[model samples]
Target chain A: MTSESDRSRRDVLILGAATALVGAGLAGPAAAELKTVVYNNSGGASADAARAAWGGLMRDRASSNLLVTAPASVARLKAMIQARNVEWDVAELVSQEHKQAIRESMLQKLDLSVIDLSHTPDDCKDEYSVVYALYSTAMAYSSKIAAAKRPGSWAEFWDVAKFPGRRALRNHPVDNLEFALLADGVPKDKIYPIDFDRAFASLDRIKKHIAVWWRDGSQPAQMLIDGEVDFTSGWHGRFFALAQKGETGFGVQWNQAMLKRSWVGVPQGAKNPREAMQLISFMIDPTASAKYAEGIGYICCDARANNHLPENVRPWVMSNPAIAELTVSANEQWWLDNGELAQRKWNDWIVT
Target chain B: MVRRWFWIPGLGFLVLFFLLPVGAFLLQSVLDPGPTFMHFERLFEGRAFWVSLGNTFRISITVTLICAVIGFLIALRIATLQRPYANALLVLIVMTVWISLLVRNYAWMVLLGREGIISTSLVALGIFERKTSLLFNEAAVVLGMVHVLIPYMIIPTYAAVQAIDPALLRACDSLGARPAQVFSRVLLPLSLPGLATGCLLVFTLSLGFYVTPAILGGRGQTTLTMLMEIEVNEQLNWGFAAAHAAVLIAITAVLFFAYRSKFGMDRLWGQEL
Candidate 1:
């Protein structure tokens, strides 16, 4: 309890009033309907989107409201579940995280009847979650970089002699495996059921030239902007954001753009699970999704969401379905099954 | 009757805020999902674990030594200043703590980045033909940690320095002791507790550092905190994370007792250092 008696009693009163308000009638009063709902995310761009596009839009319309938080971790989720005290009403999860949460029964099952998934991509939807936004693990290079030519494929990315500059990539093996396979001459269509031997071999080729094995989505972009690395494979939005600011000499090669997806799942035993599920459905609305994508520079998984955006604006936004079709969707299940092994291998590979 | 029971609130604070939660965490490290010691086993099983542990101690000690040497001079300067000047120096030192850790790390990035201010300024002055990679190096990591943790060291040492009797300094001066002799023989020995306290504070605080190393340091700079983060955040291995945390706790506990034997426990008490 707080040292201040006023605050301690007020917290108790708020709890009592919230319960009484819920018990009175589910949809009785606008002010009382959602006394509290804690929405958790991985923070940064995603949190900003929820605050502006979703929370800002629904502030006047809905009785329920969201209080945003930063960087949800499964460890925290498990600890809360074990203590029988859940804080997050709605938690943003990756595809594999959604799977793990489902296995642990750490998330509530969704009711599709309430959620109109007509606009949401079928492959994107999950048992306990709704898809949020899409990004890419694509090639980034400085046009001003000294080389015979720029790298357009993973094979060329491995060729340090031609590139002749330091490079940056994520520290994880999720997309790196696929990129390595592609670099080893595996066709884009036939990249799955990955040949591990060849992939690691492909990695060993360029591993020495990699100046930085960045961990965050934005680090590689920042490195490229700072000229710490001549090339990198990072989130397209990172370089795109820089480009829109009139920063020159940067180019993106989206040929092998691998789609990265995010989802929103209700944590099991949340105080407002029903309200959280409803909010998920509400956010899947095309206008909200597009406004979210526009504000955050991520692609909305719902194709129709971009229809709300002007055609000229879509070019700058990377919201085009044509480019989406060309880009390959990451096999989340493959990673989910082999993730620990791959991650261990990645850790050993980098450290040594 | 209740006047002597003032310690109840303090005891309540420790039990409610510290003991119960830490007890749960340690218990879970051994017995989450099912009763097991596999989490503890995991701590010793990997090369990554050993590497992270080694790096954490290495970086923290390096930061501690740097902080101790520089911070003592700062404290000594502040302690010997005129009243207004001493207050002004302290305010300047304390002002840095007001800025959040993340902003400070980002500021370091902007200054030390390849295209950052220092590099650009140097390049403009014809120092180099091309930009050099300055950030994401060991030097940057140490620089960032020292900048953030020095204040922790300075505050306690400053307190210790201020508490020394001015009459002792005057007595040494009256005995015809030179300034250097006065400091080395009298002030230095007297200020040992503060120096010890400051070093301990900076050393312990640096062990849990995350954002600075994560932002300013790259692959080679990865510490135990980052490794635990990988286990907890990326791998979702809380059992292993808890075990790793237990290792840190056990190490800190041993150090706590070690420091207690050398300098009384009263100094480390009440500060949460």
Candidate 2:
């Protein structure tokens, strides 16, 4: 027992020394003791884009620092909220989730006094969150096959006979319900508080032709590249990236795109709330947001950033004026309130 | 000099790694957000869980049946071959087992898709007027599941076949017993245990499948795991998700109990009946 306890103590000592060495390597006289804030967002390509944008710029300011992290999932966030042990200073939440956060009071109201809002739009900055990226779920089709009979809108997407082939759609009701409503001749502005009966009826028409119900943001793009299905609806960035690199032959239909904004929110009792707020303020800087948007194919609301982007990349991003005009903003609050009911209906509809 | 207390470490590992998490889930399903039956009640009251559960049973049974037939044949072929040839073929079969399930499923998606090699080739050969997709169908899901499970079926059956006495076959031939008689009376009885093992393994594994069906399954082809995921992730209905999980556990347990009652639990672990 004595030997085993001694070994554990030695192990702890070694671990402590290694950590101290790593910290010594990072620390310098010039490196001010900036309170480190873990900026939690969806990891992968978007995280890279975010790092390029706000990460370096904030670090340059030498104010409170930030470290980018992956997926602060709702479950984890809720647990932290309940326990009063907020791990992340800033969390990137989607539209409905952002609204859900506010509704649950999991997040503290942002101090707009610290964050500059002159360039950021009214809709982009709420009390709880500041919009980081506008991810558009748009109609993406096989560029090779969709040309002659391309689906210009959700209506055309459902027209299997005109452009007869298989399709992959997101399994959820979030955007698909809106697309169904739109295809059924519901106006873009009137999509929210979704007409459930009508929407499901519309979805039923094209149900037989759907070849895949894509679960991931990346799946639809690969499906298009592999020619798994002739048509699918997915995140705009994937289709944009495919087009940019000429990696896969694919086309995007921006018309009636369900554009939803992803936001960075401060947890209610974060250790570094001030730093988190300042980091969010710096993130909304027009030039940096533009760079972030260009690097990733998401759209930022700052109009000033649009002119700085290269011409070829403009058409792919939501920053493109033409593409912007084509998109319809989904109601975040409505989704927050009605998401559960919609899912229940969706579950029944999907099985049938 | 090894004591019975030596087993404590392994038991502790199982308790820590397996039992605790599953026990937490079992507890959480009932106790979380206050104890209520609404979540489990939703299963019978709603069409989603029933449909998903139905699909799970159908897909698992079908895959198990196909694996049983093909796996037994392959084992028989390998057993009848020369020792070196049998070893080479066994190596080939085992090599496929090393490949990731996702990679295998994705390969099937590529081969069976609309503009895939088979579909395009068939169209080129004037077999069809337009390009067609073979993916996102029940057949594709079954085929993918069967492909993944066949190796599991083969190894056990081969072991059983390999253990068969060759002198018995010579005696049967000398006694003027027909080839069919020898196969039915001797080989069939010997191999039944292995075939049963393969069927149970394949069916149970196929029941829990989420990835292959998620990637390949279409609108109506959704399974219980997929439904459970949506409940957890999308709805954030932990209680409901737990209920679905409990259902899965219950089904697996029921199947296992039935098997154990018939064959005895010892056979399931290693011993052949």
Task: Write candidate 1's Cα lDDT for B11-110 as tens digits.
Answer: 9999999999888867878887699998877668777777778878988999999999899899888777765676567666666765677788888888
- CAPRI class assigned to model 1: acceptable
**Interface root-mean-square deviation (Å) of every model:** 12.9, 15.5
Per-residue lDDT over A1-352 for candidate 2, one digit per residue giving the tens place of the 0 to 100 score: 0111112223222322332242233533345476677888777667777777777767777365557777647667876887789888888888878877787788988887887777878988887888878779988888678477888888988998887767889889999999999999999988878989999999999887887888888888888887777789998877766666667677778899988888888998788887888788766777777777766787567778777777777787776778788999889888888988899888888988
User: Model 1 lDDT vs. the true structure?
Assistant: 0.75
Give the clashing residue pairs of candidate 2, or none. Answer: none
DockQ value for model 2: 0.18
Interface RMSD of 1: 12.9
Residue B179 in candidate 1, Cα distance off native in Å: 5.1
Docking band of candidate 2: incorrect
Error of 1 at A156 (Å): 2.0
TM-score of each: 0.86, 0.86
Residue-level lDDT of model 1, residues A35-74, one tens digit each, is 5567887676667767777785445555566678878677
lDDT of 1 at A13: 29
